[model samples]
Target: MAKVQVLGTGCAKCGYLLKNAQVAANERQAGDVVEKLDDMLQVHEFNPSALPALAIDGKVVTVGTLPSPSEIRQLIEQSQEVEE
Candidate 1:
């Protein structure tokens, strides 16, 4: 399973991104692998210049803006591939 992490400050966009990430993961059958990080300390660990960053397997994949569900799905798929 891929480890999908959403890093944000618990704002609207952050929440949306987390939901989108969840939906994307579910679409890819990775729903149970998604995690959200709203704590400033943990979120800053990713060093995102913007809110709502998406990290897969501890590596930041998207940052600064919200990505579409399909886009996020693709990212998750790619991460899975890399894992294999």
Candidate 2:
């Protein structure tokens, strides 16, 4: 499993990112790997730089702008590769 995390407040973009991350993980057959960290303070604890960030296995991958589903899928695949 990839253990993907979507960090952000309960905003539209955040929700979309969470949904897309889940879809990407599903496409890659990573099981239920996507999680959302909607609490701002908790998000800061992970990466105080920006909201709407993406993380895999507790490591921040991307921040700010939303990534496409294809991109998210690629990211998941890459994380799995790193773990192996």
Off by over 4 Å in 2: none
Model 1 Cα lDDT, one tens digit per residue, 1-84: 788899987889988998888888888874448888999999988898777898988999988889988998898888888878
Clashes by residue pair, model 2: none
> Candidate 1: worst 10 consecutive residues by lDDT?
25-34
lDDT of each structure? 0.86, 0.85
**Segments in model 1 whose C-alpha atoms lie over 4 Å from true places:** none
Candidate 2 lDDT tens digits, 26-83 = 7887584788998877788886477789998889999987998889988878878888
Task: Name the Cα RMSD for model 2.
Answer: 1.2
Model 2 weakest lDDT span, ten residues long: 25-34
TM-score of each: 0.90, 0.90
